[model samples]
Target: MLNRVKRFADKTPFSLTTPNPQEYTLFNQAILYGVLIEPYFTKIHIKHLHAIIIDGYKLFLSLLVGIVNELYGKLVNSGKEQLIWVTKEMIDVSATRIDSLLVCLMRQIVGGDFSNGNLWLCFELVSLCLSKWDCLLQEKPVVLTSALYTFLRLLADHCRVSNNLKPMMLRQMEIEFFVKMLRDQFQLCLKIGRDLFHVPF
Candidate 1:
């Protein structure tokens, strides 16, 4: 299974900064972020679970987050890194795809079905994205604003529920930070205009 996973990872054609157009797709990204991570859940040792798997899983999660961070940066950043020109369609699909994947991963990680380690990974992933909000604002406002809407929606949904799931669900301070960032981004959009995010902020 590990060999198969490694092969899959090696053959994964979904690169954000690649020059090849054929490799770009949400389906490929889903395979990377979703399917690639699934095997670990079942393959973990039953007895020496934490000793064998926890750290590796955490690292894998971190890698996923970092890939996404870079993906966003590559999309919105100037064309210095690309050998070929990026298209509008590429930008549109790449940004929206990441947003959707992150939301889906968030749901999977936070649900009771996953282990506590995976659950906490949700916070790490969210923080990774939110930490880049300023950069996203400058480089890819549309993507950033779309992300803000998704996050606000998630926050609203979380609030409506009674289950806090201590240590897994976000703390009040974290919630405040995210809210503040969203509000500030919304205000920035107002000054910048609807053209920034493609929607009225």
Candidate 2:
């Protein structure tokens, strides 16, 4: 699939002119898959995608949302890493529906799972939220609220089950995330309502 997409990309010159809609979608799908499956060549695949992207990355992001929603757990470790990297890239570009993509990733961080991958995801996401705090608040405050609720809930589970250093580190990160949200966006935290009170400290 990557080879075929590269062949098409090589033949096609970069232009703002839209290609056939169906073909364009197919190419995006192929490239998205290639990005996830070929981590070593991610930059190359991303450059090819940028050359052909004509939809503000909406189609590519939507395809990514679907993958994160349906296949995140099944993805290999490197694939998961690439997925998060591409997500950060999309955030950098301020892609459309990026909030939804973020929410999808938040959902993928399963609570009470002390596995390394789960802990890593929790850390990565919390760090992403912290790093992009201003952009997220300005662009989609609701995603911050969602993260607040998610981490608050996860903290409860972590407190109950965690005894190791990794989980401890993740718990600390989650604490920082919600605390920042509450300190800077108290009113937004209020939107969480009764659930906020119910989360075990």
Error of 2 at 91 (Å): 0.8
The digit string of per-residue lDDT tens for model 2 on 87-178 reads: 88888778889999999999988877888899889888999999988888888889999999999988988877655988778788888887
Cα displacement (angstroms), candidate 2, residue 144, comes to: 0.6
lDDT of 1 by residue, 1-201 (tens): 445445434443322343232222222333333332443422221112222232223333343455544543343222211201111212322332344335434443434323445434445545645665565556555555444444444454455556657432654424654566546765644543444343211
Q: Against the true structure, candidate 1 has what lDDT?
A: 0.40
Highest lDDT, which number?
2
Q: What shift in Å separates residue 71 of candidate 1 from its native position after superposition? A: 18
Candidate 2, 53: how far from true, in Å? 2.3
> In model 2, where do residues sit more than 4 Å from their true spots?
1-17
* Model 2 clash tally, residue pairs: 0
